[model samples]
Target: MFRQSLPAGIGRMMASMLGDSPPSSRQGADAFPSSQSFHTTATLAAIPDPYKVLGVDRNASAGDIKKAYYGLAKKYHPDTNKDPNAKEKFAEAQSAYELLSDAKKRETYDRFGSAAFDQNGGFDPNAAAGGNPFAGAGGFHGFGGGFPGGFAADINFEDLFGAFTGGARRAGRGRRGPFQEVLVGEDIEVQTNISFMEAAKGTSKDVVITPLTECGTCKGDGLKAGAKRSQCRQCNGSGTRVHFMQGGFQVAATCDACGGAGMIVPRGSECGTCRGNGVVRDKKTITVDIPGGVEDGMRLRVAGEGDAPPTGTQAAPGTRTQRGDLYVSIRVAPDHRFSRSGSDILYTASIPLTTALLGGEVTIPTLDGEVKVKVATGTGTGDRITLSGMGMKKLGGRSRGYTPTGDLKVEFKVAMPKYLTANQRTILEVLADEMNDKTARRTMNIGKDSPPSEAGNAPTDSQKNEGFLKSAWHKLMNATKNGDGGNSASNPSKKESDDAKKSDKESK
Candidate 1:
């Protein structure tokens, strides 16, 4: 009954303002009869301090307050973060922002410490209509109840506070009011890989994305035709309802009736197109332009290319809508023959051993094409040859009329021949002898006398004598052990004796 009468009184008040006579004394008194059970008994002790909730100083500026709220919202918003307490912290930040962002609300809170907004304790709308509502509360002390002299009848609250809240009594065709919170849309990120050459030179790629877009059927309002919203009865349009707990503790939480929006739609009034969500999934193809000289693991940003914010949330009248950004992460594939360092390119070229010793022309592969380069005389292996302005083009060169390029460094590797013929060997040996190459002389077996002080090529006398004696002993033993007749044993022994005598004569 108490809930049913508040709107009736507002209607009557509006009627009186529109040239109708005011209600009679009996009618006015009956319209707002006191209801003890409907009055709130909760104190302000449990309410969190707005400044502390936002982690700001008592004297923070409005801009600073807004910045702090945005940072906290980004970290705690459910769309971006999945922490268990993110919703709670997000609610706390939003609640704090609501109080501190308003000049009148902040001033009142600073002076009265949240007690000024206490709706029930000793509050009587009928008595406060034309007189002081706090007269019995001892000069607004502790809100031990409500405000003293809430307001004079001459001052209409609806007109004065319309900008701060949804005015119930104001004449309007539809419900369009300031929302408590406005959240940005969700950001999107994607990754792609490009070849090494494509990274050196700019390229364009098409990326497919599925994102949330506003529903066209209902125009993002989430309402059927001719539908209207009403204030939630559970929370009295405060968006939060009080919860009583053990030990005299009181908690204010979001109203389940309206999903914390302070308003509820009539039964079966939701738009069928998006099922009251005001958004639908849509797949789109977007072209991304990659710049030249972009390094691996670089991210490119595209603005206003993400999901759109809900229609119900807006900063103010005539403010532009905000959309999130798109980020593209790039990965460059490695090349087979070429590697990069900053803006330079490195490559190795294999040249024949003869080409390194004598000046010659060798064809090398480069970014542009194969180019012939002259090898310097006596050029050795591991030598580097640099080709200026023949490497990767610098980033942003197309717009500058002339492209700036890096250098391509080519390293020379000498390739030696695996085999040589007799003619080649003889010529090389003659050449080594003319050049007095001691290493070649020691390594190769050319039938010639080696230089003195090097080891002798022949074995010593002891080596010859030991071989002759071993041969004679092995022959005699084998002839006897075989059990051959006297002729077979005597013939083998006779041959060994002759060979031993010949070896002794040569030594002498």
Candidate 2:
């Protein structure tokens, strides 16, 4: 009777071991009172250590634990294994895995045994009586006689099964969820070089890109001509496979055969154009408007110009798939004559020495055009001339009703003549003599002790007839002979006195 109730494979193995003729039904009934009584007795037995249940040591690593769980789950799955107690053993292994996989839970189980998770003092037969409808009756309740709150609740059975089944998660249908909305096409980055003037002012450019699009031959269905579609055998047209876990929970995973589409075509029935991929690479052209005041290395975002999303990855039911943005990195060529500092432009202008000394108008190049700037008479090298509103436009400063602009600073570089002609040299010499004579007379006047003759005081005849150049020259010559380089020419020497007296006598 026990052999009859056992799975065919298990029954054969047991019969071979204990002989063909086993105990009769009446004898078996006498040994075990009822199925419920037997289940309760088995569940109340001492719980096995989690490490032993998973077939690992106490110091096993997390990877080891995971490997052992996958091996045991595959071997004891109710769908594959025919053993009558296979479901119960699988539940025990799953429970062990759930506890040992978590660092905190594992530590608690190791320190306090299974009692750490038990709300009650010990195993309670009443708790098992409150059976899980999903597991059906007579299901084995292992640790603590029931499921722990944080143990099986936190385990994602789909992920655990998918690890062995090699499956993917299917996109849910309906209004776009947060996770679905974030599944946009990838953004693209490209680099382009532009002229300096183009970067200073705005310009437009046409960019060519090859983005993925739905195939025209298969109409994004990934089917060849004359090929018929049929429901997927793996998922039974639902596009997902449900796996029943030990704790009365179910998990759905994407069907691997049809890739969650719930349909499939026979081999060699795929469309030749897209090779059953549903998407193809196509060329697209988009115009990008680069704004003014954009600096080098600045990225410009062009919306909906990048690669398109893969087929069947649309957002909401009514909305179409969103294309990612295109980021264009700008590289500005260097200008020989102009350099920038913020919004201001710096330019070096060369001016003749004569033009610098004598005030004149100088022509300077600006972004607008060449303009004449007035140079001061005493302008020197390294002098800067600022022209208002002739520089780059302000980036974000134009909203206050006044369009602000930066100044164009022109730095002067005095260009002195390296070679002078004969006639020029002669003229310069004469000019130099005249300047020296004027300077000597100014020096003499500055050395006078008295301030000046008063209006009422008339000048004497001797003062009026005084020869300033003669007196200055005689004083200078006398001071030079006396080795008194530091002496002033205000006082006359002995020789000057004798010469003056003789000149006066001769005149009389």
Candidate 3:
């Protein structure tokens, strides 16, 4: 098998293994007044150990597993390795160790755990083991072994160190600077809305918000009004105790008694109102700006408007609410006439048969206002009339037209009449005789709509052609029967308005 080298003890959170965890309290400790170099040197470095990598029970750790993983990863780590499978093997070892080392994670493994950690099944390492490609038919190797894990014996110290700790470079960031608080920004929430027109057209509006700010008094110092520092008796001015762990590597941390600053404050020094470190919690109002062209359910974020901190908190230190953010959720009410699609608006409009045929001006409702649009003489139903630049506001651009503007599609739904009058029917009969079934039948436009279940069945081609002819015949017969065929358009419709009124009354 191929082989490579890896440095030892890198990428692993060294403190997680041997050092005492931070105080049990959720709040962090007081800030340390000073910080020396926290960088680890050659003298301070520790050897690479699989136990360290997994963060496990040292007494329960094993060598076979580590050796197997180290071998595979060493081969493919790329830096010192050349085997293609080496990298995968290394990653496997890392994952296995991570789970086994964590107490909670290891407990799960002891149960019916699995390799599919993300699937919530369990964290398993051997679920899909590798094979030695060179092995024979039965996947048996000539080395007096089966290609079970197919891992070699060589270990890569260089790879181990680099992979475990991210090298000394990243480790530096984990070190202490001047001790500060567990500075957490304030969190806030707000409810807001935008109009459908504003959402489509894109507009900016102001929203008042409340947020947390810091107290000026203690200036974040948790001490009393006149409090001064007193030297710590235990551990002297050095605020912490240092001890060696994991062999010869030393660990140093804050003093438990004084909370790390190397000094204690007299009880009187505590602030009378805020108790010392000056930060206090208070709500302040602010104006947040919301931008336009936002969709329903979209959110507008205004940074910095939440609760403040209480000044003195963790070992690092705490500050009150400075500012959080405001998230405005846009909910545009549905307009009765228009529906929205992204930024476009849609609505249905109706026109009389005279206007559709002869042409005339019909009042069209635009978002800004209503305007009269000329229906050119002879305009058919389904004819589209576009009002350029009258769609929705562009997100970022202002100049451009035609394609940029929304198109208004006028789908003519030729409505005949709610009821017909005697005189109206007479004229309709004459018109039916003149045009026959040509335009009227074609404009019903039902066939292309949908299945019968959706819009009901369409008129048959023959049935449509007979509409005008039948109207004409009805008029002639009516005239001969002692009654005038003048109720075509203005009288009760063929739908039987009387029956409809009766049904409504009965339903009531």
Which structure among the candidates has the greatest lDDT? 1
TM-score of every model versus the real structure: 0.50, 0.46, 0.44
lDDT of 1 by residue, 214-326 (tens): 87887665667887666679878765565554522234554666654566665678777766655677899889999888879988777667887554322122323456678
CA deviation > 4 Å runs, candidate 1: 1-182, 232-236, 240-261, 264-267, 310-320, 394-403, 421-431, 441-508
Shift in Å, residue 33, candidate 3:
44
Q: Write the per-residue lDDT of candidate 2 for residues 1-508, one digit (tens) a residue.
A: 1111332333333344333543345443243322211121222222457799899999999999999999999999755676877866776687678778879778766765543343212323333344321111112222221122221212223433322332222222211111121234667888877877786777888878787777889776667888866777887865556556653444455566665456666568877887765567888877788766667888877766766655432221222354566888988888898888777889999998878988799888888778888989978999997888777767667675775777789999999888764344433443455467544223223223335689999866544433343355456656777898626564458558878899999999
Question: What stretches of model 2 exceed 4 Å from their correct place?
Answer: 1-182, 218-221, 224-269, 312-320, 397-404, 423-508
lDDT (tens digit, per residue) of candidate 3 on 145-248:
11122322211222234324532221111112111112345566666667777766666665555444555666666665666656667647555545445533
As a TM-score, model 3 comes out at 0.44
**Candidate 3: which stretches are off by over 4 Å?**
1-184, 200-208, 228-269, 275-278, 315-322, 376-383, 398-415, 438-508
TM-score of 1: 0.50
The per-residue C-alpha lDDT of model 2 at residue 298 equals 83
In candidate 2 the C-alpha lDDT for residue 278 amounts to 59
Question: Cα RMSD for candidate 3?
Answer: 23.6
**Who is ahead in lDDT, 1 or 2?**
1
Better of 2 and 3 by lDDT: 2
